[model samples]
Target: MSARITLASGVTLNTQIDGPDGAPWLILSNSLGADQSMWDEQIAFLSASYKVLRYDTRGHGQSDVPNGPYTFDDLVGDVIGLMDALSIETAHFMGLSMGGMTGLGLALRHPDRITKVVCADGRADAPAPFVGMWDQRMAAVKEGGLEAIADGTLGSWLTEDWRAANPARTKSVRDMVTATNVDGYVACCKALQKLDYLKSLGDVKIPVLFVGGSEDVGASPETMGAMAAATPGGRYVEIANAAHVANINAPEAFNDAIKGFLGV
Candidate 1:
C-alpha cells in the first residue's frame, strides 16, 4: 500500500508499505537524488520477513520539498514523526548515502525508535574534503542544475564496468537524478555539507552494520570500517566490485550482508 502521509512537521512524505501484516517493521531510506524505488530490488527479499516501510526523504521523490538548508534534526525528526503517525514504536532502519546518514542520526537522537541500523555507503563526519565536494556540487547545481552533476554522480555511484554492462539501468538512475527538484537537491547538499556525527558514534548502543562498496571512493571501505569500529557492536561488510550504490550494483551481496546482520 502507498500513500502521502503528513507528519507532525507538516511535511508530507510519500510512503509505501509492503510484506505480511503484523511482521516486524523495517524502514528503507533512499540516497540523495534517488527515491523509494531505489530499493525495489530488496523489496521482495526484505518484505518476506519484514513489514517493509519505504519512503522518499523530504525534497526527493514524491515527498514535500521544503525550503533550503535542511538539518540532521529535520531529517531525523521526519522519521520520528512518520513512525509516530503510523504508531510504529520501533523498527529496523536501513539507508544508503544520504539515507545512511539519516540512520546514524536516528541511532544517536532516537535510539529507542530503532532496534538496529544498516547504514550503507554513508559517512559519520564531513571533513574538509567532503565539505569541499558538496560545495562544488551545490555550486554546479545552482549554475547548471542537476544535469550538470548527473554524469559525475552516476559515475561515482556505479563502476565503469557495471555501468557499461547495465546501460538501461544506468540511464534510469541518471533520469532520476536529473528529475530531482533542484532546490531540494541543493538544500540536501547543504545538510550533507554540515555532517558531523563521527565524534558521537561511540554513544550508539545498538547494533549497526556499516556496508561499503570496495570501489566507493565517496564513502570508502576504510572509512566505513572505522565507523563500524567506533560504534558499539557494529559490523562492517565490504561488497566486492560495487560502488556508492552497492545495493543496486550488487543486490545479492548487499541482501546477504543485511540479512545476516538483521537475522531475518
Candidate 2:
C-alpha cells in the first residue's frame, strides 16, 4: 500500500508499505537522486519476512520539496516524524549514500528509535575533498540542471560492465536522475556537504552494518570498514565487483548480506 503522509513537521512524504500486517518494520531509504522505487528489487524479498516501509526523502520523488539548504537534523527529523505519525516507536533502517548518512545521524541522535541499521555505500563524514566535490556538483546543477550531472552520477553509481549489461535498468535509473527536482537535489547536496558523524559512531548504541561496494571509490571498503571498526560491535560487508549502488548492481549479494545481518 502507498500513501502521502503529512507529518507533524508539516512535510508530506510519499510512502509505501508492504509485507504482513503485523511484523517487524524495516524502512529502506534511497540515495540522493532516487526515490522509494529504488528498492523495488528488494521489496518482495524483504516483505517475505518483514513489513517493509520505503519513502522518498523530503526533496525527492513525490514528497514535498521545501526550501533549500536542508540539514541532517531536518532529514533525520523527517524519519522520526514519519514514524511517530505511523505509531511506529522503532524500526530497522537501511539507507544508501545520502540516505545512509541520514541513518548514521538517526542512530546517533535517536539510538532508541532504530533496532539496526544497514548503511550501504554511505560516508560518515564529509571531508574537504568531499565538500569540494559536492560544491562542484551543486554549481554544475545550478548552471545546467540535473541533466548535466546525470551521466557522471550514473557512472559513479554503476560500473561500465553493469551498465552495458543492464541497459534497461540503467536507463530507468538515469530517468530517475533526470526527473529529480533540481532544487531538491541541490538542497540535499548541501545537507551532504555538512555531514560529520564519523567520530560520533561510538555513541551509537544500536547495531550497525556498514555495506559498501568493492569498486565504490566514493565510499570505499576501507572507509566503511573503518566506520564499522569505530562503532562498538558494528560489522562491514563488501559486495564484490559492485559500485556505489550495490543493491541495484548486485541485488542478490546485497540481499544476502542484509538478510544475514538482520537475521531474517
Candidate 3:
C-alpha cells in the first residue's frame, strides 16, 4: 500500500499506507528533518488492525519541496488532498513536533476530517526559547547546508544513551536528516517562525490524546499537561526514556498506548 502521490501543489509525497479497510485510520506525521520511515515501528504493529498512513512533510524524505513560507493551511491542504486522493473521509490523526503542529492546524480548520487527535512531543504555542534556535538553525542550514543540523537533530531526536545503544537505527535517522536539502529545511524553518496556535487550540473538539517523552526538552510533559488541562477530555501520557520521537525510542509502549487510546 505504499505509493508516491503528486499533490495539487506539485509536491510528490512518498507515502506508505498499510492495514485493513474501514478500520480506524491512523495517520502518522514525522518530526522535523526526518520522513515517513521514522514511523516504521508503529506502522508494523498498527497496520495489522488499523489502517496506518505515514508520509514525509514538505522538504523532507521523498516529498517534494517546491517553494518557501508554506502556511499551516498549505500543510493541512496536503493532508486533506491526500485523503481525497485516497478516498479517506475520517481518520485518527497523530503527529510529533512539527507534525503535531500540522495536526493542530487540521483540527482547527477542518475538524470534520479527524476522528481523534494525538499530538506527541509538540507544542500548542511556539515557545519563545525555540525562536532563537530557529533563527540560528535557518542560518546554519542556509549557509553550512543540511549536514550542519544532522548531528544536532540526531542527538535531540533521541537521548544520548539511546543513540549509543542503537547505533544502526540512530545512523539511519541521522542519514535521513543529513540527506535533506538545505533550501527545503530552511523553508520549513520559516514556516515555523510564523506558527502559533494558541487561539486555535480552543477550537479543536475531537478527543485528544497528548503523549510526551519523559526526557523531551522541546515540548516537556509539563507543557503537554497544561495543554491537556486546557482541552476537555484530553488525556496526557508520558513515555519513559524517550525524547522527541517516542514512537521510535519506545515503540511497544507507544504503540500500545495509541492502540488503547484509539481503541484499536
Candidate 1, 1-264: lDDT as tens digits: 999999987999999999999999999999999999999989999999999999999999999999979988889899999999999999999999999999999999888889999999999998899999899888999899889999999999999999999999999999999989888898998899889999999999888999999999989999999999999988899999999999999999999888888877
Candidate 2, residues 170-200: lDDT per residue as tens digits? 9999999988899999999999989999978
Please rank every candidate by lDDT, starting with the best.
1, 2, 3
lDDT score for residue 95 of model 1:
95
Worst 10 residues of 1 by lDDT: 255-264
Could you give the C-alpha RMSD of every candidate to the true structure, in order shown? 0.8, 0.7, 1.5
Q: Which stretches of candidate 3 lie over 4 Å from their true place?
A: none
Prediction 2 global C-alpha lDDT: 0.93
TM-score of each: 0.98, 0.99, 0.95
Off by over 4 Å in 1: none
- Candidate 3 C-alpha lDDT tens digits along 153-244: 87777889989999999989888888887767877877777788865666678888889889888888898888877776878899988988
Which of the two candidates, 2 or 3, achieves a greater TM-score against the reference?
Answer: 2
